[model samples]
Target: MLLLTCPWCGPRDETEYHYGGQAHVAYPANPAELSDEEWAEYLFFRDNPKGPFAERWVHSTGCRRWFNVVRDTVTYEVLAVYGPHDPRPELAAGDPR
Candidate 1:
């Protein structure tokens, strides 16, 4: 019953979106030289935060762009939505806004 507000598509049912995992992840400069463990770590590991977290989500049934979403893990509350290249401004320390 969570309402996910997409940046380009407006509010939508959660089922229409696909979670794209942590945003801002960059590939290594020298990927050819990476060890197996390093490669696996980059591919599988993530800092799974508990509260308001920034993540990537695709509006699969709508605009189809992968955008960033700030949401609460515990209550499934959506905070904000922005495009992939958006420069997220710093919100107040405790406020979700």
Candidate 2:
């Protein structure tokens, strides 16, 4: 099982957490001006990266708090775990978060 470090609760079994999908997505600043395709993209599209990625997770069995994690897509190597209030970590190349 993958081990995840919860900044507040310390390291715990991955089973204690819940993956919350891709993180740090921002809504369009001017949604009114976006074309139909652009609006659809924002609503339905998310990057499927092959390498490192940032994702949101919830410690459902622990703190029950949400946090961000940077991990490798292929290897599942967790590089960092930080709270929502913290600044984004230095991500692997091409990681938008």
TM-score of each candidate structure, all chains considered together: 0.85, 0.80
What is the per-residue lDDT of model 1 for residues 66-96, given as tens digits with 9 covering 90 to 100? 9988887877877778889887646568754
What is the alpha-carbon lDDT for the whole of candidate 1?
0.83
Question: Candidate 2 at residue 95, lDDT?
Answer: 51
Q: lDDT per residue, candidate 2, 9-73, as tens digits?
A: 99999999999888887879998999999989888888788877788899999989999998888
* Highest TM-score against the true fold, candidate: 1
* Leading candidate by lDDT: 2
In candidate 1, position 4 carries an lDDT of 83
Error of 2 at 35 (Å): 3.8
Alpha-carbon shift of residue 60 in model 1 (angstroms)? 0.7
How many clashes in each structure? 0, 0
Instruction: Give lDDT: candidate 1, residue 93.
Output: 83
lDDT of 1 at 38: 98
> What's model 2's lDDT at 44?
80
Query: lDDT per model, in order?
Result: 0.83, 0.86
